[model samples]
Target: MKKLRFSAFLAALMLTTLTACSTTDSGRRTVGQYVDDAAITAGVKAAIVNEPTLKVSEIQVETYEGVVQLSGFVSSAANIATASTVARSVNGVKSVKNDIRLK
Candidate 1:
């Protein structure tokens, strides 16, 4: 019973810590802007994934104030261009920074 109580306490503490961290003020991002950036990142990733020609796992998406940045490696120049195009197609993406390296 004591061990189970400790385990429950640990789980609650971890959950509190995670929730606090998620809401912490970060960089220059207000909490609302942070949420917007997260949405933009998700949107770009979805666009890239929906594109049949690109491998979504090889790309990383980040957004700040509607600007989407794409990083990571792709097998060809075509993939880089495709990623940029897909990112641009996402509704919330203001601009796309394609930094994908050719493998």
Candidate 2:
């Protein structure tokens, strides 16, 4: 049991080291920047869900460096537009990319 525990600990240490050295394709982000992007993504999703006309179940939100990206299938062009508008209204979002498509 002690040997198995040591092996597991070693594996976890290696995994943590690899992840700590990894950089996202969009480029490297400081921990603070990553947190900001996460907040922006959450805010955009909240806005979409809050909008009565938007179907939150059909929308996806992603944010990087303060730019929010909305990509998913909506029932109409208006929903796509509304999603973009809502994302842009978020406080930390620097820009909005609407890639929503009509079904």
Candidate 3:
């Protein structure tokens, strides 16, 4: 009886630990993280559109664990700076790594 009780306790402890480490409702990303990523993407797109010098053919915005990665090709360096600025301005973006290249 004592052995069974110990096994059950160990199982419960393992279950609790696993649950604590599991990802939240947004599949791989938490609810708050998802919202932040969406906000960052929207802000970057808006900035690209508003900037007259930047002619972005394809804008790829990816967020991983609150870090936003901006990948695309633009006409000039100024466009890249503009995009980075746009991403930084959005709330919840921990950092922006600009991988944008000049076309």
Q: Quick one: best TM-score, which candidate?
A: 2
Q: Evaluate model 1: give its TM-score.
A: 0.73
In model 2, what lDDT does residue 49 have?
82
lDDT of 1 by residue, 1-103 (tens): 9999999999999998766556435446566678888988988888887899999999999888899989999999999998999999888889988899998
Worst 10-residue stretch by lDDT in candidate 2?
Answer: 18-27
CA lDDT, candidate 2, residue 72: 88
lDDT (C-alpha, whole model) for all candidates: 0.87, 0.87, 0.77
- Estimate, for each residue in 32-70, the C-alpha lDDT of model 3 and write its tens digit: 666667777777667667767665456688877778898
Top-scoring candidate (lDDT): 2
After the best TM-score superposition of candidate 3, give how far the Cα of residue 82 lies from its true spot, in angstroms: 2.3
Worst 10 residues of 3 by lDDT: 50-59
* Higher-scoring candidate on TM-score, 2 or 3: 2
C-alpha lDDT of candidate 2 relative to the true structure? 0.87
Candidate 3: deviation at residue 8, Å?
32
In candidate 3, which residue pairs get closer than 3 Å at backbone N, Cα or C atoms, i.e. clash?
Answer: none
Root-mean-square deviation per candidate: 6.7, 5.6, 8.0
Candidate numbers, best TM-score first, in rank order: 2, 1, 3
Of 1 and 2, the candidate ahead on TM-score is 2
Which residues of candidate 1, in runs, are more than 4 Å off? 1-27
